[model samples]
Target: MNVTFRCPPELEQVLPRPVPAKVGLPDWLRRMPATAHDEVLGVELMTVKKCAPFLDAMGYGFLMPLACDLQIDKGRLSWDWDLPATPGETYSRSPVALHAAAQVRGSPFEKGAAPMLKFNAFWTIELPAGWSLLCTHPVNRTDLPFRSLTGMVDSDRYTDNFINFVAEWIDPSFSGILPRGTPVAQCIPVRRESFDYRFEVMTQDETDAFRDTRDSMDGTAGVYRRDMRVRK
Candidate 1:
């Protein structure tokens, strides 16, 4: 599916372009060992680094990056952006904003939530008809200092403006620079569809099939990768 990403003329050259998530994989994933010694089993076993599904999820879709480096010192956020603003118009020129703490009340993040960080996106995304964009925290990326709240937008219909990402700050005490090009959001284009729901007990054939699959998985490594997974 073809998708278009556009930004303000002033930001076209200033901001980093969005890229596939596979290209921005965290360094830990690249450095992790494929196999590790399991103390319980007293043998070397494959780690998640060798798991196809886990890797696939990590690399799926595209990443929206931070527009500029942000300085966080003792829970205060600041930036050094000096881009020229458009004449005769008013809009946020900053790369980030904050939502009131009350907005997240009653949610798990509410208890200790600092002002929720809002990544002010400069780019506007447009997807094909019948498609929406799923914006979520970078999958399996617990290393980030914040967790992006999940949301879906009908990008196909709302392509006129930017869709900012809201996130729960993980560490108010984290004092450092969140550099430009760091992924603030992971976006996946999802085709709209309806589903019919059904629930049923396993039949004899289904039971046998399930057992066979389970036994194969228990007996060998990469059974799903070798026999079931569709190659990307």
Candidate 2:
């Protein structure tokens, strides 16, 4: 599966290149040892198993990093993304005003969801045939100030344009430089296929085996890695 980034010429020098999740793993996670998960529970608040899975979910695809540090002034409804394009033009749109939740509908989860705040996208991604991209907030990162709304694009069939990380500026009080290379979104490429859903109960023998294995492996830390998970 080839996923090409159609970087506009102007952004080549300014935009931080999108990279694989492994390359940009949060510093805290880097110190974690998969073998000695018990010791890491205090600071991380999660067993290695729980934390690993969350990263696994988000780390499956490439991450779109912030092209440049964005300095936003919520009080003034102003911002700056220094991407010099063509002589006089800049890359980003004007700082947008945040909206109140009462002005919109539905129960929103993100911190900035109440306000209809949006910005322009910087790049266009070209996906391979029969593939679509799922754009979502970087996984397992509740620390980020703003929350990105999830969306899907059929990249395979629609290659004429690119996509953006249109998100809510969750932190209203946060007014400063959001350093360059900060991840704004995660893009997961999914193969398109049709299938039906079905529900079935396990047989008596299957149920017994499941219970026995679970009981035997309950205290083991790497059961999924050593016993159940298929080696990629």
Question: Candidate 1, which segments miss by more than 4 Å at Cα?
Answer: none
lDDT of each: 0.91, 0.68
lDDT of 2 by residue, 1-232 (tens): 6888776687677667888876677876767654443455544234453444565775678888765556667734444665454776444443233445554465554343455555345667888888999989888776777777788999887775657656766677887777667877888998889999999999999999989889876756557666666422
Evaluated with lDDT, which candidate comes out highest?
1
Against the true structure, what is each candidate's TM-score?
A: 0.95, 0.78
RMSD of each: 1.5, 4.4
CA displacement after TM-score superposition, residue 97 of candidate 2 (Å): 9.2
Q: State the lDDT at 95 in candidate 2.
A: 26
